[model samples]
Target: MVPPTTGPTHHLGKSEIEYYAMLAKTEVQHYSGTNIELGTACGKYFRVCTLSITDPGDSDIIRSLESA
Candidate 1:
């Protein structure tokens, strides 16, 4: 996978690195919706204080939140 490029501000940047790292190291079960406290869970990624996708479609939204 390509390394993530740095963003303009330090706090807000591409999640490619984090996502891929989670993809590689975090177990699928850790992502279950029941585990809201898990950092890798879908809920954490969608938390309003965090981030949002641009122009995401229905399937994209599902793919982002519905996956474990």
Candidate 2:
């Protein structure tokens, strides 16, 4: 895979967005629906927080919780 880039704020803003993400802690709740993708098998990793990833190609939008 090609490596990500680091450039000026606007030109390489997409990479910056990937660095931020939403925290889903196991203590709370997490479900992909009736078909839980990760499954209840998540271990201590379950106790930890999971980060929500966004498609890095969408540079047209601003970076926020969903975009992060």
Candidate 3:
């Protein structure tokens, strides 16, 4: 039989979601007014995005990290 996974499913809270959003390179917004209100306090620092790593070598590096 298959064994259980290491940990329970942990849902990301609004704060955690915002945290990652801020780390992203673009603006992150939610349609919900509640999210807007909460995220607003953080100022414009919070946003949605990604860095352009066009170097093909990066793919190999990413794969290595995922395997690790």
lDDT scores in order: 0.36, 0.29, 0.34
Residue-wise lDDT of candidate 1 within 1-68, one digit each (tens)?
Answer: 22223223134343544665577763221122222233243345532222334354564543544552
| lDDT, residue 39, model 3 | 38
lDDT of 3 by residue, 1-68 (tens): 11111112133444454565568643333332233333353244543121222353634634533464
Q: What is the total number of backbone clashes in candidate 1?
A: 0
Q: After superposition, how far is residue 19 of candidate 2 from its true place, in Å?
A: 0.6
Q: If the candidates were sorted by their lDDT against the true structure, best first, what order would they fall in? A: 1, 3, 2
Model 2, 20: alpha-carbon shift in Å?
0.9
- Index of the highest-TM-score prediction: 3
Residue clash pairs of candidate 3: 26-48, 26-49, 27-48, 28-47, 28-48
User: TM per model?
Assistant: 0.19, 0.16, 0.26
TM-score of 3: 0.26
Q: Extract clashing residue pairs from model 2.
A: none
What global local distance difference test value does model 1 have?
0.36
Candidate 2: stretches off by over 4 Å: 1-11, 22-68
